[model samples]
Target: MQPAAPESAAPAAFSYTAFALSLIAGLALGIALGRLLGPLPGGEAEPWQLRAEDRNHYMLAIALEYHESGDAARALDKLIALKPAGDPLVALAEGACALGSGGYLADASGIAALRSAVQLYQDFGREGCAERLLPEAAPAALPAEPPPPAADARAQPTPLPSKTPPPASAQTAQTARLAPTPLPRRFREHSLRSFCDIARPAIIEVRTVDYLGRGVPGQRIRVRWGESEDIFLTGIKREYGDNYGDFQMEEGVEYAVDMPGAAEPLATALSTGSCYSDNRRGLKSWRVSFVEV
Candidate 1:
């Protein structure tokens, strides 16, 4: 009653719940419209919107396709569409270098094919550090020796010779056969040379051959750089000759090449720091040959 408490009016409480509901509804509506309308005009397509790593993979796919189809114009157009900063060939080389350095050459499927395609492009006047990343092409399988001419099924055994030999020359030949003849050494470093060639940079070319000087396929060549080592077999690249297996070198690092049973490395202290060719620089290469002793 006390004059009706002066009817002191209280301000209405703010409706936080209503504000939050409105915000959520508006966001959902925007999303729905965006989905219906798709990407805005002038926006990049799905391929172009890929991240750097994904983009590289896309380029690799294009390369592989090109390799299979042998369509240069199509491949070039596809690569140029990627919006690479400079020459598309450079991008191809960079991708190849990345894959090689990342150990893709070790065992990944299709990696060799990708590298081969990249190398094809690299040969078109764009060079990168990918030359050495390429693995030797697999050697053609050797034909098995025909089973010793099947022994004649109907032939008779020959008569035994009389055991009355007393010749001095025969005796000397027998003694020589009994005496030990030194076995030829299995392997030796034949030659080593360092030079610069723009076409092939930072390459450590290895060739393994037999006593007859024919390429010895399946021979293993080891390359050592600091604490790391890589073993590659010859005959992988038939085009390079069956005896050939090459390794790529990194800048500022020393490398050594050796065979399994060799007394020492075919080449040591090999580096690419000083070798230069033409107006370009830094593609020092070495050639090492190994032969059966």
Candidate 2:
């Protein structure tokens, strides 16, 4: 009886505990992996990413600093990195770098860059900067030197065949069309100063309102000077003002501002009659309110 029947082992109960543990582990792993590959907190972008305007402004600063440091090569590199290769500011910087690279205005690259910058500035309503780069209109052509007094045939030295072709200096001068010439140090200093002057910010403000005296946002303002016109939009800039936009105005220049929604265009006089204390130098502005025509 004791040996009776080896008690049949009770069928092993299905392990719910093990199955639950495995499922929990899988879920934990999935969560960890998702977090590891997920985007950064706050969904932020790479810090290195730069906006076009920001990049342009940064390069201008670096280029200007390099010019002052007399580091022409570095200045040029900064300009080359600038976007919109056709930007007048970039062209101006390139021209300045070329000129400061011990070539003065004789440097062909510098002259070309300056010419391009001048045209772009004109097209962009930057007359002050453009005017500075343009050559004086109708500059008198230099008189041609009289032909070398006819050398007496007897006085001319007989040409002797040389085994070696020519001196290195003479060969270089003959082969290279653009030889680097030494520029006076003072000239570079002057050029850097002029660049600073031209590149400095001269902020101009505009505010638009409707006849009901309500601020008008998204109004397009066309600023005209000389033969150039530039359009900008109005927005609310914090406490600066609602329906406001700002532009940089060249010193001592007048501009005509037209708003399509306004009854009439506003013309800036010698004095806009309104100036503000802004970080930018020579801050001026115009306040326009539309009225029933």
Top of the candidates by TM-score: 1
Q: What is the per-residue lDDT of model 1 for residues 1-293, given as tens digits with 9 covering 90 to 100?
A: 35543434654476788989999999999999988787644454666556667777788888776655556678788878887655576666666666667766665344545665554564363434455566666322233433454378876755543333235574465344331323434678888888888888889898878788977654567788889998776655657875688998888898877875443675467888666666677678988888887
TM-score for all models, in order of appearance:
0.37, 0.27
Q: Which tens-of-lDDT digit does each residue in 1-293 have in candidate 2?
A: 46555546655576788989999999999999988776764457432234544453454455335323445455545555554334334344333333434343443334433443333322332222323344555232233444465578666654433223334575365335322333211100000011122232345566655545555554456677888877765552435654567666676677766654332455333223233344434334433443222
Worst 10 residues of 1 by lDDT: 138-147
TM-score of 2: 0.27
Q: Give the lDDT of residue 25 in candidate 1.
A: 100
Model 2, position 191: C-alpha lDDT score: 8
